[model samples]
Target: MNMLNVSSNAFMIAFFLYCGAFIVHAIAVMGRKFSNREPEAHVKKWGRFGLILTLIGLGSQLVYFFTRWAGSGHIPVSNMYEFMTFLSMMVIVAFAILYMIYKTSLLGLFALPITIILMAYAAVFPQEVQPLVPSLKSIWLNIHVTLAALGESFFAVGFAAGLMYLLRTVKFDSSAKVDKRQQKWLEFTLVVIIIVIGFIGTVFAFRASGYEAVFVQQQVTDVDTGGTNDSKIEKVIYHMPPLVAPHNSDTESYTSFLGMKEPLFEAPSWMNGVNAGRKLNTVLWSVISGLLLYGVLRLIIRKPLSRALSPYLADIDPDDLDEISYRAIAIGFPIFTLGALIFAMIWAEIAWGRFWGWDPKEVWALITWLYYSAYLHLRLSKGWQGRNSAWLAVLGFLIVMFTLVGVNLIIAGLHSYAGTE
Candidate 1:
């Protein structure tokens, strides 16, 4: 009967549909390799099916979104959990629109997986709806964030297309003189992806094993009573373990290895957000686990991760991929500017009594905008198209990620409204 329960169920169902779509799209692409006769027709059938499944999934998610909005009595984009979910949902919608224009089944292979990963990542976070703090009670919360997510979702599609372009265009044949720097950058991208997967896997493992602990400093007020408790509540350190726990966190529950905590140095005081320790821990674990994964793969294959992934995308059209990459950003940049910068400033003025503060989030937003501005300027005006433009598009999206995720995780500021919940 509760809204949360109903919305959660719908979200799960939508995720499965997305998973089904991924499988079908994958089959469509793979079928192209096998069915020489009527290959286009064969792939089209499967692609259509995949699109239908994706549309169904999107619809189900929309139902979940509205149901949550009805149940929660607000747009469900407040916390990291809800914001990530909403972003994935927007990614789905954006991908759907792009698929209509490009009609490429291969696009699904990249785009759908991104959404799936985002959905899985979002699911891992605490999903409880929190009462809005004073700043977030305004109508602008939805307008500002929802628009920004929509803009970024389009940029995400550009990232996917840019990635696909790099895979198709970049040489990995070993016979051709490969640029070591290109290989290194590609490997770096793979490591970034591995880090995300690593975080998800480690968190899932901890939760499955019921490995929960208490961080005495986790600032949380009771839901019913705005009263603080004398003793700290039990919280799971899901960011994989803190590389350096605060001196005060050496509790009985804080497990250690060989009578010492890993990276014995204490976390810097500046990292003092509510879940600062956990977020830092998550980053460390992500990097360490990602390196381990990259090392293991390198040992097995004796090649860079990018080279390993290149063959899959080798057959894709370089021009189409490049066009999609360019088009996505061209369409997205204006929307992103209007929403992330303009609407954000308007909301900030209303909420914080200023249009702009040098908040980390605000700074990063400006950086993202400037980076993309240069990207567009180079591509359109300076004739910096092809691999150079693709590279810029790819790098620009990284800036977007830093603005979106890094801001929330590393630096706490007025935009820390998400953490207030």
Candidate 2:
């Protein structure tokens, strides 16, 4: 069989393995009857085993992705199927990173199963190879998409950790109850993971693929002063024209217009005469600013601020979880900015001859970016720490998730790459 078929099969097997691992992890969480002492050595062994299995499953997934990339001859992110696969792999990688810091295998017990569901959803989409269009052939495509995926993956981890933080903070009856809460945390983590994954997966798999190219042609008569009616032909352009391959006969026209004809809708007033490249650079700088903000936070944490501050600030060190979540967002916010805003704008400029058109997807992306920016600002300026900041982290992720998936499926717009129809 060819590489895509082989990769698809491998992904299917990995999906099942993830499901089985999720189940075993759940059982381990449920079987814990007491938390009076550290979990029994055997229970720890089981947890370790589950984590190892999850890692193996994730490794297999990576192989499948690389093989598919080799077969497809482009980054596996042009369409919904490939993008969903990328998102799933990203979630696993993010979870692994968090596990390294906290050494909490419990998170993966939940995260892996959620990853499985996403891969399963991805399976339903068409995995057929589609050549990369001229517009997608850019170095920016690699930098913009890969970084965005990495940043979003970290946000995914923050979301899981935030949920766990919420669960951990809530008051429980006994240590056993806390153990039960941990199990609940596992379940909640899985749900959040799936929700984020499913949102992206469903849009690409079902909605983006289903988008239809619509065209309308009209004939009108132009009024003439000399009592003559001049017949005029007008083409009501609504959707982007079909992309032509570089080596194809139509390559001249395709390259001349930069791979697309015109906007489906009239350019919005706000976007009139704006420089697309400048807008892209602005968004890139915003992402860099976010990263710098995270660095400042890290530096602050490294110093002994407790000596200069009040007793309360000293007592509650907002250094550990808060810093981690902040750094994750700082790094991710820019990537999200690049993918959902910058590259998207570049695509819009090429396809529609304008950028920042306030399409539903575009609007939601701005909203997502602003929401996280607020989270960082509030956390830093207002001293929003621990649970409060973590909750905001969770909300920020939800907004990003909506921008990634919900906007494409629930709202109609020019960005239809996520649909399967």
Candidate 3:
């Protein structure tokens, strides 16, 4: 219990430190002209400060991880909370390594936000230290999951650099067809990121308010025991207000919100997973809150979000950002292959007596691997560079994210144990 408490405190310390690093990095990038200071000197001094803070934050997170491991009598990456937090830590590691190699403050500015958002997202899930399940009891769990996440973290850094490259180079004011199309897509990408932030903010807000809604979900299953049927009753709890009820569920206890005492509608029969309706409701809230946040920002800025932000990136070298992005992805590709594919197959064969299964998780992992493979080929062979390579890197990370998160949430398979409650 003492170790667990210490671990929790260390995690909080790390979170705050990372947030501080982000602000300092942003200052380093954006505050170059302030007080008529020499731009190069200003960036160098503040970028050093940001790097110090980031290193300290990484140290604190390591403390959190090892303490939790000691407290739990096993590695801490066995559950959603631990895995996501671990992923965020790995992202910091990847960012720190790249930042050191390139000495780029803009990389820190973009990458630290991703690390912070992932930490916040991880907090939205349950954080209790649960024992590893039978299948997850192998050493491969550590190798497969950790390496895969480390690889993905590099890919994440690549995404950040790629995005920075786009923001630095794209002609936001141009009305030409190519520039206009690029502007729209870039703004759309920024919107998706803001939506994720909104989702995290909404969850924490409702949680702090102590909101609750409960439902009794009744599911009927067909059995193969000489032609029989079974009815199962389960309770699904919603930490946020219920906007969509399960398909065949009845309200057990309800708290009215905004003059409403019932869900807006029941989920369709096709959405039959235990928490599918709740998941859908959460998605709806995320999109709503995200768009609302974007709208408010638009109103305040009086311009497209990307356009307003483009000037800050004007001094950055788009070519350097592109190079960093490509190098990071190149380094991560083989690590990802080893962890997500080779090690995974070894573990799966040992656990399930098969080397391959068309499970959703497995399929998505394969798809992600193939996509990145294509990306590398295109970059090396057809000489895809600048905007083209940047876009691919950005989109590749999205696919990696879906493989890690979305597949678990939306698809039921052998990896369902990895999903959130």
Candidate 4:
């Protein structure tokens, strides 16, 4: 078999192995409900099985990593699909090491599902390997992005712990007596969930329907020292249906969408680059599609996801969970700063002539960095202990995610390679 196919098979195997591990870990944590005295020895045996499967999954994915490098002649993290898979693999590896230190199956219970979710989310993107663009052909592509993704995987683990802490601690005053703070936190969490579900659902829908839209635009370049080319037609292909049609489609194949007016507001020149308003179109499509999906899911589920998970957590120690949540951010903060900010700056200076541009991606990276730094600072202080620190950790990851995923979808910039699938 060719390297790509072999790598694909390896990824699939790893997915199944991770799923098996998640199920076993979940059972080990909640099996006490099933038996009066679920033997600690039995749970430990099952945990070992889960750990073994996790290691096997890691090994299988390592094969994919090597074969993908051989196939692509570069690291697999040059695009969203590859970077996501690699990022999830890194999370699993980090969790493995942390598990060795903490020796807690509870961490696996919360974290393994994230790896599976990431793998699923990555599958929704364009998986085809392609030649790297001129901008992405630098060695920094591997070094900067590899470190950034690894660092964020730790943040992902922190998110798990943070979420666990909130679920264990946060409670509404009552149905009759609702504390606004608790209500707001719950609402914020649900909105984030909706966005994730919405994005994933829209991607799946487009892929299944084979829906494709093309954006035609004009291009200008300095030809013959001062001449420009406006005659060239740039065709931008989008698998998702357009919710907001672009006004610049010179081609007759243009299909107006959603009763949107002839011309919507235009993005800044830096946003869509040469493709005109395609980035704005994508952002609109994703937002509208996500809202619809979120509404439908809310109607069907009728409860926040945390409520469903709270029962299983009863046996898990709240203090331990809180500590893990704190420890995760504490561990992830320096690593993230080094990779996402420092290495990023060094690479940017090499590639783009400047170390900082306040590009959406760069700004968001800085925001993520500052937020986590504050999280660490507050954590070390006297007052912000359990709930506050957990909230900050969760919020920190949200910004990291926005830096990682949202900026790519909503804004265009030099740092798009890691995300612009």
Please provide TM-scores, in order, for all candidate models, with all chains considered together.
0.89, 0.60, 0.97, 0.84
Off by over 4 Å in 4: 134-139, 173-180, 215-233, 248-302, 418-421
Give the range where candidate 1 is weakest over 10 consecutive residues by summed lDDT: 231-240
For model 4, the local distance difference test gives 0.76
Worst 10 residues of 2 by lDDT: 244-253
Off by over 4 Å in 2: 27-44, 171-327, 337-357
- lDDT per residue for candidate 4 within 109-165, as digits (tens), equals 878878987887888777888788776778887777887887798888988887887
Q: List model 2 lDDT by residue over 267-354, tens digit each.
A: 2223311222222222233344444543454477663222111221222223454666666676677777787678867867866688
Q: Name the lDDT of candidate 3.
A: 0.91
For residues 1-421, write the lDDT of model 3, one tens digit per residue. 9999999999999999999999999999989867385889999999999999999999999999999999998888877788889999999999888887888888998999999999999998888888778999999999999999999999999999999999999997788999999999999999999999999999999999999999999988879878798889989999888889988999999999899979999999988777999999999999999999999999999999989988998888899999999999998899999999999999999999998989999999999999999999999999999999999999999998888788777788888664387
| Candidate maximizing TM-score | 3
TM-score winner, 1 or 3: 3
Off by over 4 Å in 3: 224-228
What is each predicted model's overall lDDT from 0 to 1? 0.80, 0.59, 0.91, 0.76
Which structure is stronger by lDDT: 2 or 3? 3
Clashing residue pairs, candidate 4? none
Write the candidate numbers in order of decreasing TM-score: 3, 1, 4, 2
